[model samples]
Target: METTREGAKKIAHDSTVQSLNQLLEKNYDAENGYKNALTETKSAQLKPYFTKQAARRSRNANELYKAIRNLNATPVEKGSAKAAVHRTWLDLKTAVVGKNDESILKECTRGDITAVNEYEKVLNDPEYLLDSKGMIRQQLHNIQISLKTIRKLKDIVD
Candidate 1:
């Protein structure tokens, strides 16, 4: 059964990686097309907006990552635990939003940092078990991994 589960996990990871690559490729094409259009246009005023919009698209991608983390990190139990997770999620979401609006990568980094912090909180809580929250925390970890790669890519681009 463990082998079977491991096989399934491998298949799932492969599929997700393939899909993510496709999405990134599409985004690259779209960004290039927009930049090309910006280049040909006579108006200089519109270029900044396009540049900002592209940045916003990247920011939105990070926001989506946070949302995924929040969804996965939601406590299974209600009451105080639920409230706590919800509050932490809100704080993380707010940080992402505020950072994105300002076009700052720090916001996304902070969001990831907040997520790790909240995950640690869940780990420390007696109500939540490590095993029970394993999958959810793993999903949250994916966001962290993706954000790290995104930051690296951004650095290369800049």
Candidate 2:
């Protein structure tokens, strides 16, 4: 029979894995969001920015995947199905409204906010492992940077 301590540890580990997977999904969504923005936006100035953001998000996902593997959990290989549906909605909205740079920036900012929230949840959870905190902090920092950039772009558009 599992001891109480062992059971507690198992629960903590499971919670940590679930949080990490959530972050990974957000990263995947951000990557796809930036890619779509890059392809859809006609602004030469914004294309390079979106390209860089996409690459950053891909890197973030890789980092999260490694962290999840280190915890002996299998990371999610793709973004959430909800995110996919949201992307489809974004595409339809863009097609109907015209691919305005401001609108694209707004969408990207929303994605960043989602990522930031996921990371914050993991960071704030007392059950999360200490070793993983550093990695989560780093990922959060990167997401914040991207958010700031997106906001700056939005300001420019405004």
Candidate 3:
């Protein structure tokens, strides 16, 4: 008994939910990546920075989760499998070769780039609801700030 317009609306809502979920997953990945960097880095100066970034990513992920729930969608709690593997590799490399702050910063920068790209995709998609754009824009700005910080640190150390 759904009209065509109703079905279209449903599709748009579903797409928005899916995009939000993807963004949430990226936030989870960033959170884990920052945590790995914090634990693996030997630099005292960088450890606190990584810790703060990790906490920020965690907060962002929780915010995304709440947003998705508000849209009546289930939010995934765990990061992607590829993210877990990447973290494991980083940990093993650190254990074998020793901690390098530059390398950690580079990896963190890559994760930030991914996060920014994910946010952009959602923000640019017309299927995404207008009401959600404000949150997405703010989160994107935060990720961009983190990216800039990582790049600056990498430049300083390299």
Candidate 4:
């Protein structure tokens, strides 16, 4: 029974680490995506907002890295390849259609939505990790606010 409990704990820890790494990748992607949007968008008014978002995401990524390391797991250093592809697509779309504020905000909103979903998944997972839950929820709330801000900005642009 003791060995079984230990093994179960180990499995939970491993699962939590995996989820954290995935969230870290998401933060990285969001950070880079915001930077890209900052450079490519013609909306001067949104530049500062984009910069803030990039910084926020970078901070989030660092937090996630620390959490994974604390759990004795390797942290993912960069965004996922799928995110890279999405960034590439955004660039191409901007180049082809020209820089539109609505479109840029739309993409940002999408990225935030993805982050929110991932955070929610981890928070609701079966790991029973209360410590991890608080951290994830804090970040999740921030991302939710970001989504709201993006939507309001897009509405203003429209």
Candidate 4 local lDDT, 1-158, one digit each (tens): 56988988988888888899999999999999999988877777899999999999999999999988888789998999998887777678767888788888988988888789888888889974566778788899999998999988988889
Which pairs of residues collide in model 2? Answer: none
Clashing residue pairs, candidate 3?
none
lDDT (0 to 1) per candidate: 0.43, 0.89, 0.86, 0.88
- Model 1 Cα lDDT, one tens digit per residue, 103-137: 23343345445545544554454433233345445
Better of 3 and 4 by lDDT: 4
TM-score of each: 0.35, 0.95, 0.94, 0.94
Better of 1 and 4 by TM-score: 4
Per residue, candidate 2 scores C-alpha lDDT tens digits across 54-137 of 998899899889989998899999999998998898778766878788888988988889788878988999988787889889
Candidate 2 achieves a global lDDT of 0.89
lDDT per residue for candidate 3 within 42-142, as digits (tens), equals 78888889889889888888888998899888998788999889788877887798778888898888888888888898888987788788988998998
Total residue pair clashes for candidate 3: 0
Candidate 1, pairs of clashing residues: none
Q: Distance from true position, residue 122, model 3, in Å?
A: 0.6
User: For model 1, what is the error of residue 53's alpha carbon versus the real structure, in angstroms, after optimal superposition?
Assistant: 2.7
Tell how far residue 146 is off in model 1, in angstroms: 22
Output the TM-score of candidate 1: 0.35
Best candidate per TM-score, number?
2
Strongest candidate by lDDT: 2
> How much is 26 displaced in model 4, in angstroms?
0.2
- For all predictions, the C-alpha RMSD in Å is 14.1, 1.1, 1.3, 1.5
